[model samples]
Target: MTIGELAKRSGLTQSRIRFYERIGLLTTVERRANGYRVYPPEALVILRVIAIAQSAGFSLDEIRTLLPDDRAHWDHDALTDTLRRKVADIDALALRLAQRRAQLVTLIDEIEARPDDIDCADNARRVLASLFDGD
Candidate 1:
């Protein structure tokens, strides 16, 4: 198939296909007599895999490392290790986000618990002090 056909079938723009080729991510390309690019059917599969990997948080560099020129060969251990590392990173991020959410909830509660007699300025000072003192 031609570049246009590959782009249409892959659901990617022509420029994006060309960019992938230039970046060495899509290597199964051949030039015809008129200088037009021809792509094999496997190009569609590779493009789909690239899109799925990207959506799974794998960077272009990471994807490149995972996808070799020879489709039959894949580093299973490296792929497993990288996936585990990404999961761990996601877990750490979730913990941090939960902590931040709890802190924000605490701050909101503190602000809402201000005394009726105290002015806003004094309440602000009290809240600031309580936060700093870890109260």
Candidate 2:
């Protein structure tokens, strides 16, 4: 199909298709006699895969590694490894976020427990001491 038809079918702009071609993601693109880009029917499926991978937090470079012209030839080992690594990354991020939330909650509790007779500076110092003194 022509670039426009492919764009309409793939839900991607023509420039995006061309950019993918330039980036070596869409290697099946052919050139017509008039120098217009011609795409096969499978281009739409490839574009959809790219969109899905992006939604799944895969970078274009990673997607490029993950995809090939033939789906049957996909490296199951590599795909599995990458997926496992991404899960680990997400797990680490969740742990860090949890720790940060707990720290903030502790700070809020400390601030709220401050006696009304203490000034802001003294309260801050007390909070810092409690936090750093490992109590």
Candidate 3:
């Protein structure tokens, strides 16, 4: 298929497909006699895989490493290990985000718990003391 057809089928813009080819991510392209690009049917699948991997948080470099030059020659163990590591990284990020969220909630509660008798400056000092000295 031509670059336009590939772009239509892959739901990617022509420039993006060309960019991928230039970046060595899409390497199955051939040039016609008139200098037009021709792509095999496998290009569509590869593009879909690239989009999926990207959505899954795999960077282009990581996807390049994970994708085998020959589809039949994928290293199963390496793929599994990499996926597991990504999952672990995501888990660690989730833990940190949850901790941060909890801290924000605590801070909100502290800020809202100001006494009516205190001025804003004194309440600010009280909050700071609780945050620093109480910790």
lDDT of 3 by residue, 1-135 (tens): 999999998899999999989988898999989999999998998899899889989999999988888776889999889889989988999999999999999989998999999998999999999999865
Deviating ranges (above 4 Å) for candidate 3: none
TM-score for candidate 2: 0.75
Between the candidate structures 1 and 2, which one is better when assessed by lDDT?
1
What CA root-mean-square deviation does each model show from the true structure? Answer: 2.2, 2.7, 1.5
Please give the lDDT score at residue 109 for candidate 2: 97
- The lDDT leader among the candidates is 3
TM-score per prediction, in order, is 0.82, 0.75, 0.90
For candidate 1, the C-alpha RMSD (Å) to the true structure equals 2.2
Q: Is candidate 2 or candidate 3 better by lDDT?
A: 3
lDDT by residue (1-135, candidate 2, tens digit) is 999999998888899989998898887778889998888887888889889878878899989888865755878898888878877887988999999999999899999899999999999999999998986
Report the C-alpha displacement of residue 5, candidate 2, in angstroms.
4.3
Q: What is residue 119's positional error in candidate 1, in angstroms?
A: 3.7
Q: Name the runs in model 1 displaced over 4 angstroms.
A: none
